[model samples]
Target: MQLGKAVRLERIMNRNNGRTIIVPLDHGVTVGPIYGLVDLRETVNQVAEGGANAMLMHKGIPRCSHRRHGRDIGLIIHLSASTSLSPHPNAKTLVGSVTDAIKLGADAVSVHINLGDETESRMLADLGAICSEANEWGMPVLAMMYARGPKIENEYDPDVVAHCARVGVELGADIVKVNYTGDPKSFVRVVEGCCVPVVIAGGPKLENELDLVRMVHDSVQAGGAGLSVGRNIFQHPNPVKIVAALHKVVHEDWDIDAAMELL
Candidate 1:
């Protein structure tokens, strides 16, 4: 671990708690500016004000969302993307580079890898290439690893999730993000499999806010470093409320019951 990378990762994850709440705004590239993201700056401001550790976005967005007034938030540039319209949307292809992220003043860079996808080999190869580039610059890399594709029966299976997370660590990711295995006990295997920090992803919008908070709480209990949840936090009518609640759960050691009060 280089000093440069360590220092940069501190900006993304709280050094004391070793946890982070990263809101991904890169959804626009994949899903077309759905819901809350229509105003990326405002959404970023709201979450930043609520104490989000970082915000992840594609290259063009950092410049637009970087503002002068709100609390400073760390930025992670997403390097891969594929639109919903694509025939194989799960096959994420690199749309930017580590150099591009650094030029955009990103504290970290992330790439998506769908393990069981038809193009897994390409995505994995690209991940290795980008990681090498990131190493040269001493930039931290977060791998968005998922068990998605034809063969996967239940992506949430703990074994499958753990394998996805391990792939990130094996490939040199500083941090790994994968889906939670419904409960804390099951997700523990995921954290144990990867020596690096592991964060859980918010798959889709949940029906209730309590469910979101509970899921985050359980993941934390299972030793998750934090969350890279997007739509669940951003799409809520009160984005700040949700991010604030999540901040408490991830950083302040608040219990599920206590955390739910924020919402």
Candidate 2:
């Protein structure tokens, strides 16, 4: 690995455990400035204070959330975007570049790809190009891959999830994020199939906190790197406590019970 990329990866992943707890705050582009995201500084600070490994946001947000003091958090500049109001919301387009991320002082850059979307080929092309450009600068690329299309019956199906992860690996992503396959046994297959580290995505807000932590715990047990959760963490009544709990679960290998204590 390039020293530059390795150094930056350490900022977003626990050096000892090789795991991470990333909070995505880029939803403003898709859904607008929703509840948990209206106050960028506070949200960024709360997650950082809670020991989140990194915070992912759109390219334009660093100015709003950059911290001068307190715990430092890794920044991942999201390069792709699509508005929910769009008829083709799943078709993400590259709205930023690796050079832009470097200018923003991002630790990494990420792109979203919906495998089954009508524009799947275009998104893949964008991901391939971004990976090539990022490699030149020794920047890490995180690919958020999902199986969302008309032919898909269940996105969480183990086979489907594994395919999404493998596509990212084949395309040169350093880290791949996909939906969890419901249980550790099935999820393990997804992890085993991918050479690169696989992280689970928090699809939506869970009604029960236990469900959320258990999912993270199980994924780790199945050899997942960690999680890149958005609404589940940021939308919680207390984002700090939830992020802290997740930090323990991911980096410390805490069981659901012990991690839940933080909440």
Candidate 3:
């Protein structure tokens, strides 16, 4: 790996713990500007101040939301989008290029791929293209791979999630984001199958903060790298506290009881 890219990846994943707490703030493209994101600059600052390893956002966010002063966090530009209201919501399309992301001072670029979607081929092609382009610039690529489609009986099936993670590695992703398969035993398959680092998605916003904290604990126990969470952390009334709680789980390997105390 190029020293520049290696150094940037270190910003996202802690060198000591080999894990990360990436708060994704790019939902506006798919779900409109929801709570916790109306004021992008403030939201970014809140998570960074809480010791989040990185923030994944769309191209425009860096220009509009990056704080002039505060804790500096790694920035990853998400290149794919598909609205929930779309007829084929799982069919993600690329809206930004790696070169565009690099110009925006991105440390890395990410792409979303729905493995069983009707447009699965298109998304895979986009992943390959982005990886190729990102490699030339020595930028890391993070693939958010999911099994979502009419044919998929269970997106969180352990076998299916393993496939999702493996695809990210097969396609040259430096890191892979996937859904947790409920427990450590099942989720371990995903972590083992992929050679690259595997992080769990926060999934839907849970009913309580403890549920989110427990999920992070479970994923870490399963040997997963960490989390790429969004609403559960950012949309919470106490965003900074929530991220601090999760940081304990990911970096310190705290059990639920210890992590929950941070909340």
Worst 10 residues of 1 by lDDT: 61-70
Cα lDDT, model 1, residue 78: 95
Q: Scored by CA lDDT, what does every candidate get?
A: 0.92, 0.94, 0.91
Evaluated against the true structure, the overall lDDT of model 2 is 0.94
Cα RMSD of all models vs. native, in order, equals 0.8, 0.7, 0.9
TM-score of 2: 0.99
Most lDDT-accurate candidate: 2
Off by over 4 Å in 2: none
Q: Could you give candidate 1's per-residue lDDT for residues 1-263 as a string of tens digits?
A: 89999999999999997899999988998889789988778999899988999999999987678787869999999999999999999999999998898888889999999999999999999999998999999999999999889999999999999999998999889999999999999899899989999999998899998898888888998899999999998898888888988898889889988987777
Off by over 4 Å in 3: none
Q: Where does candidate 1 stray beyond 4 Å? A: none
TM-scores for candidates 1 onward, in order: 0.98, 0.99, 0.98
State residue 71's C-alpha deviation in candidate 3, in Å: 0.6
In candidate 2, position 54 carries an lDDT of 95
lDDT tens digits by residue: candidate 2, 1-77 = 99999999999999887899999999999999899998889998899999999999999899998879889999999
Cα lDDT tens digits, model 3, 1-263, are: 88888988998899897899999998998999999889999999899988899999999878889778999999999999989899888899899998898788888999999999989999999999899888888899999999998799999999999999999999999999999899999998889899888999998889998888888899899899999999998889888899988888888878899877767
lDDT: the better of candidates 2 and 3: 2
